[model samples]
Structure formats: C-alpha cells, structure tokens
Target: MIEIGHTPAKRLVTIRVSGKLTSKEYDTAVPEIEQAIEQSDGKLNAVVELDDMRGWDIAALWKDLKFDARHFDDFRRIAVVGASGGEKLSSKAAGALTSADVEFFLRDQVDKAEDWAAAD
Candidate 1:
C-alpha cells in the first residue's frame, strides 16, 4: 500500500509505501503526484520515502515504466529513502525514470537531499 502526504503550499509531496505495492497501489499514487505537479506548474519537488516498504508487484513495475515514459518531466527532483535491499532495488528502478535535466538523489543524506530538492 502507498500513502501519499502533501506539504502545505503544495511545494512538496511525500509518498510512503508500506507492504507490497501492486499496480493498483501504483495507479493510486499518480493522482497525488499529478496534483503536486499541477500545483507546482510542472516543475515539482517530490520525496519518495520507503520505510517498512516491501517488494513491488510486477504490474507495478510496468505501471512505473509507463508513467516514466509519458510524464518524464513532471518531476524536478526525486529523493528516495530506503533501508532494505528491496528499497535499494526500488531506488535503482528509478534510474530509467530520471532524465538528463532531472536531479535524482538517494535518500541517505537527508539534509543534502532536502537542499537539492529545494533548489530553484
């Protein structure tokens, strides 16, 4: 399951994933991110925090691929926080989603990640 939380002023969005993530859960994630993108006028900042998050369903991977293929520029920066091997794998999966212009940072350094995400 994925739980989405938005910061005030619509400047930042955080996605928390717990348990196995299926395509359905992934599908549910889009609207929140899309809304955050819209609020940020296309160049949005986001944090994908994975705590107690398990592996992803095959369909979720497909959904992620499609999402990246279509809305590649919506994200300005993506910070992934994970502690487990599955989280590491999940973070790597985002490589395909990143573009030359997009900044992708691992979630290890919280302060640095926040500073990077907050950059104009």
Candidate 2:
C-alpha cells in the first residue's frame, strides 16, 4: 500500500509505502505525482518513506518503469527513507536512471530526508 501527501512546501511530495505495492496503487499514486509536477511547472521533489515495504508487484514494477521513463527529467530531487539493504540499491538505480539527485536516509532520519527533498 502507499499513501501520498505534500509537504508544507508544495513543491515537495511525500509517499509512504508499506507491504507489497500493487499496480492499482501505482496507477493511483503516479498520477498524483504527475499532477504535482504539472502544478510545479514541470519539476518537483519527492520523498519516499518505506515502512516494511517488501517490494512491488510485477505489474506495479512495470508501471513504475514507465512512469520513470516518462518523467525522467521532471524531478529535481528524490529522497528515499528506509533501513532495508535494497533501499540503497534502489536509490542508486534511480540516480542512474534519472536526472534527479537521489539520496537515501535511515528510517530515523525521515525529517532530514523531507528537508533535503524540500531544499532549494
């Protein structure tokens, strides 16, 4: 499952992920991010908080790749908050696949992650 919200600074979007993410969730969440990008005039920052998120479903993974390909340059920064080993690898992959600056934070440092994502 996933929950999407915005920071006080509207240009920053926050996504909380838990359990196995489904394609339905991606279908719902990606559009919210797209809207944020549109409202921000093509660029935005994002902070993804992972809480016991095992991984994505195959269909969700496909949706994720399409979204990333379509909006590769629409993100300014992406902060991933998690403690799992895969989180670091995912962050590196994201950095390599997109122009956004990607950073990983331990679960306790979510505040820092949010601040970094919202930074100017």
Report the number of the highest-lDDT candidate. Answer: 2
TM of each candidate vs. truth: 0.76, 0.93
Give the candidate number with the greatest TM-score.
2
- Against the true structure, candidate 2 has what lDDT? 0.87
What does candidate 1's lDDT look like per residue over 6-62, in tens digits?
Answer: 763646677777788899888878887777767775567767776677678899978
Compared with the true structure, what per-residue lDDT tens digits does model 2 show for residues 1-120?
Answer: 889897535588889999999999999888887777887845799998989998889999998988889988989989999997788888888797789999999999998998888888
Deviation in Å, model 1, residue 93 alpha carbon: 4.3
Cα-based RMSD of the predictions, in order? 2.9, 1.3
RMSD of 1: 2.9
